[model samples]
Each structure stands twice: as structure tokens, then as C-alpha cells.
Target: MLAVLAGCTGGSRDIGEGKPGSSGDAIQIFPRDGAEDVGPERRIEVSIPDGRLERVRVTRVEDARRQAVPGRISDDGLSWRPAGGAGRLALASKYSVEAVAVDAEGRRSARNTAFTTVVPDHRFIGYFKPENRSTVGTGMIVAFEFSRPIRDRAAVQKAIRVTADPAVEVVGHWFGRDRLDFRPAAYWKPGTEVTVEVGLRDVEGAPGVFGSQRRTVGFTVGRSQVSLVDAAGHTMQVRRDGELISTVPISAGAPKTPTYNGKMVVSEMHEVTRMDGRTVGFGGEYDIKDVPHAIRLTESGTFLHGNYWAPADTFGSLNTSHGCIGLRDVKGGGGSAPGGWFFDRTLIGDVVEVVNSPDRKVAPDNGLSGWNLSWQAWKAGSALR
Candidate 1:
């Protein structure tokens, strides 16, 4: 009885050729032993020319998890193949096949073979915002920045699901090829819970590129807070749940370098950070090593930060700095300064709207400023339509 099998490989291979005078049956296996980089669409089967297949078993191991590949033998026992839906192999996985065959003379032969599926050369991952288990403001938008440019936007979009606990309708919008943002028609209600399910694993996002993420992230919406910055009036009205809380005096950008006007979300905050003019395309005009209470409003270096170098009276009376909203605060933060006071009450997803500025509205894709776009316009960006 023959116990070992070996075969030549191209896309598929035939294994275990019996000797001319041998009584044992020759067992054949597709995807011959030692096959590498096999595609998921290839067929997997075992067969013999003139004998009955007694048993056939296939197992697949992927990401350290092993599972059996369901299959069945032909009625005549001459062949065996994976069952429907199991015919497609898994990518980046190792498969092992074992088979036993009985010849007409009652001789038995066994064969074993193994192969490896393709490891995608190009893989994409999404870096999402708001984090898992975080509590954010109502204005928070679930955004994903994909590592690779996705050619099949519909496929990528379908792989992700964003749902709210209160059962609001949330839709996804594609910001070009690398970013996807999800939001409801209006701001999320306070105390709402949102869940993001990313099921992109092995999904073809582009030609020859696959996605490698399978995760579930969730966040809770805290109280609603939206601060309106009036550049012309040099004041910010802080509102909490439709009621006016406090009015903060602010110094917006100068006339020459005006702040962008739009609905912007607070994407980041820092107690104290350095601000350099050169970093934002401006010449070496000013560089503050310690700008306190910095709240990032846009990706283009627009910040609502503490202003110590400017005269204390510069706030509320004059638009002094370049393109950042300045609040009254001393160097290194702390104290009862308006900058620190507001920063303390802020959440990552809080909304900050700047009105009456000379500059154009902040782009919708800049930071998390999707609220700047109308609901119709936002929905128009969806690939699914």
C-alpha cells in the first residue's frame, strides 16, 4: 500500500501516481503539496482514476485559529471536493488535506498534502476616531482614515456598519478615496450610544489589495455643547442643551489672515503646545513655545488657543493673531482664564462654529468638519446612493 503522495504544481497539481505494477490506487489532490500563494477562488479536490475514496478531510489554519473545511466524496467514491461555499479558500491561511483510497483489489493507500493561501501584498487598515468606549459630545462624527486608497468605494463602505442605540439613521460619506465619515442627519441626541462594526477582513478594497480589519468600536454621547465663535463680534457663546451657558470673549484672526468660517469640531486638545508660524505656511513671523489651552478645530493649523503674548486687552477688542481664535490666558495655562475654563468643560467631539469670518468656510474634509455640508450634500457623497 502506498502511503505518501507528491505532485507537480502549476495552478493545480496531481499527486500520488502509483507504480506500473502496484495494486494500490493513485490518489490525486489539487493544489499539490508545498503549494504557495494560492488564491481563494481556486478549487480544492481529491480523486482517484479507478478506485473508491474511503475518506477525505481538509483543515485550514488562519490567524492561529484552526477549522475544518467541509467537503464530501463523490457518490461513486472516485472523487472528493469541498462543499458549496467552502470551495473558496481563505486568504493568508494554511490548508492541509488528507485522503485514503481503496483499490478494486481491496488495497488501501493514504495521502497527505499541504498548501498556503496568498498573503496579500497590499493591505489596508482604517484608523478611526472617537476611540473605543469613549464618551464624546453630540457633534462627534465617526470617521475612518484608510491606510491605502480604496478603489472600490462601495465594497469598502458596505464592509463598515455604524448604528446608533436610539435608532437614528446614520449614513456614510466618502471623502475622496482614503477617508470615510459617518453621521446622522442631525446632531446625535444626548446620551445616545453609537457602535461601529468594521468587517473588512479579506475584503477586496482595490485591485490586488485587501482590507485587514475586523473590529467593533463603540462610544457614548455625553451632554450637548456647541460653542459659536463670532469673529466679527469677537465673542463666543457657549450653549449647553439649547440653553445659553456663558459668553466668552475671544480674539479671532487679523484682517490680513482671517480665520475660516464654518462648523468645526474639536478634534484634539492640548494643555500647552508650541505654535510656529512657519509650520502653517507662514514665514517666521511668530513662534510661541507655550501656547496654552490649544483646541484644534481644523487640520490646516486652525486652533482656539490661549494668547499670553498679546496684551490682555487684545482679546474681545481686537483681532490680533494670525488665523487662530485666542482666549485670555496666562503662559503655561492654569488659573481662572477663559481659555482654561472652556478647555476644562470641552469634550473631544464638541462643536465650535466660527461665523462672520472673511475667509471661506472650512472644507468638509478638514478635520471632522463634516457638519459644514448640508444633509443633502453629505448624502450625495455616498457611493451606495
Candidate 2:
């Protein structure tokens, strides 16, 4: 019977037999003992040809963290496999399976086995935005920037799920091969809770390059706040929940380098940050070490920041910036400065629409500006379509 149990390891040399006086052949574990380089697509299971399975326990250890792999035994006690999302084996991990079975004669038998999942030559991961458990503006879009270019866009997209509580339709749009952003048809209604599930583990993102991340992150949508910037008028209107809250003077991009015209989301905010012209492809035109209350509006370096060096009159009357929106502020920021006030009130996902600028509308893929695209156009970028 011990030899029979050893055979149940599928010819594996390393097999653990049942206790003395029990039928070792009564229990079986798949992937066998000593299995190595097992692919995730291969299912891990335990079974008995006859009698009944009493209990089954599976565990996976990766990166020094031990996690339970949930599973259930069949009603007939003939088989057991992982349940639901836990069925997918994590990459580069060690899995252990233990099972107990009772034979027709009422003799209890135990079996223990383990296997190591495949460690790919290359792995891919995604760095997502809006942070877990964070409260963000309604315009926040769940975006993922992958570490490596993805070849199987469909597989990668399918692995991710973005759902909301107040349940509006949300869809994902791929920006090239390395970025994927998800959003609803319109800005999320205030107070919506959003959850993102990234099940990229073991998913083939490229040839022989498997995804190594499996995580769930969530964020809540705060109140509605969208500011509209009129470059021609040199002013910005701040609105909260469709109510005009304030109208502030501003200086837009100069004619030679006009700001992008269209809806732009505030992707980042800084109380004070260095601005180097050379970093954004400008020829050393301006390098302010401490640009106060800087808000990033585009990936290509367009900011709505405080301009202390420019004449106080420059705001509200001049479009003097190379391509940034400027508001009046002092050297160290703070006080009731318009720049600081806006920065204080702004959330990461808030919208900042620009109008009347000669420059073309900001591309939908630039920053989190997908709101600029029509619903139909946005859906067209989805890989599932």
C-alpha cells in the first residue's frame, strides 16, 4: 500500500505515505510531491477514488508571507479543488496540500504534498493610481502603468475589474501597451465608492513574461469640484456641485505656447516644487526652484502654479507664462493667496478645464484627461471590444 501511495505521487520520488494501518492509496494529491516549475494554469487538487474525503487544507507561501488557499471537498468526497479566486496559483510561490480521507472500511488515511509554481524568466507588474482607501475627487480614473509593455492586452484587461457601488458603467481604455485607465461615462456622482481588482497573477502579459501582481485597491469619490479656466478671459471659475463658488484671476499660457484647451484633471498637486525648463523640453527658458502651489495638469509639464516673480498685475491681465496658468502668490506661499487657496481646496482627481486657448485640446491619454473623449470614443479603446 505504501508503494501504491508512492505511485500516486505520479512517479515522483518524494512522497509521504499515510500512517501505519491506514490505506495510503485512499488519498491522492495532484502536482504530486516534489513537483517543480508547475505552471499556474495547472490545477491543484486532491481526491479519493472511493470512501470519503474528511478534510483538505492548502497553503501558499511567497515572499515570507503564508496565505491560506481556500478550497472545498466535493459532495461525493471524490475530489477537492481550490475555490473561487483562490484557485489561481500565485507565481514564484511554494504550495502545500494536505488531505485526510476515510476508506470504506472506516480507516483514516492522510497525504501531504507540495509543489513550487513556475518562476518566469521575466515578470510584469502594474503601478496603479488613486491609492487604496483614499478619498479622491469624482474625476479620478483608475490608471495602471505597467512595468513592461504588454503584448496580450486582452488578457491583461480581462484580469482587472473596476466596479462602483452606486453602480455606474465603468470601462477601461488602453493607452498604448503599458498604460490602462478605467472610468465611467461621466464624472462619478459624488460619494461613489469604487473598487479595483487586479488579478494579474500568472497572466501572460507578453511572450513568456507573466504578471506577478494580484491586489485589490479601492477609493471613495468625494464631493464634486470642477474648475473651468478661460485662457482668453484670463480667469478661472471654481464650481462645487454645479454652484459657482468663486471666480479668480489667472494668467494663461503665452500665445507662442498656448495651454491645452479642453477638460484636464488635476493629477498632482505640490505646495512647492522645482520647475526646470529643460526637463519639459524647453530650452532653459525658466527654472524656478520653488514654484509655489503647483498643480500638474498634463504629463507634458503644464502647471497651474503661483508666480511670485512675475508682476502682481501679470495675473488677470496677461498671458505671460510659457504654457502654465499663473495665479498671484508670495515667495513662500500660504496666506490667502489664490494659488494657495486653490491648492488647499483641490483634490487629486478634480477637473480643471481649459478653454479659448489656441493650442489643441489635451489628448485623452495625457494625464487623467479621458473625460475629454466622447463615451463612444473611449469605449472604442477597450481591448474587449
Point to the candidate with the largest lDDT: 1
- Please identify model 1 stretches exceeding 4 Å from their true place: 1-120
Candidate 2: Cα lDDT at 373: 90
Q: What's each prediction's TM-score? A: 0.69, 0.69
Scored by Cα lDDT, where does model 2 land? 0.75
Candidate 2 lDDT, 129-227, residue by residue in tens: 776787889899888877678999999999999999999999999999999999999999999999888899999999989998787778899999999
Worst 10 residues of 2 by lDDT: 1-10
Q: Residue 341 error for model 2, in Å?
A: 0.6
Question: Which residue pairs collide in model 1, if any?
Answer: none
lDDT string for model 1 (285-355, tens) is: 44443456777787666778766556677678777556678888875576699989999999999999999
Task: Tell me how many clashing residue pairs each candidate has.
Answer: 0, 0
Q: Give the TM-score of candidate 1.
A: 0.69
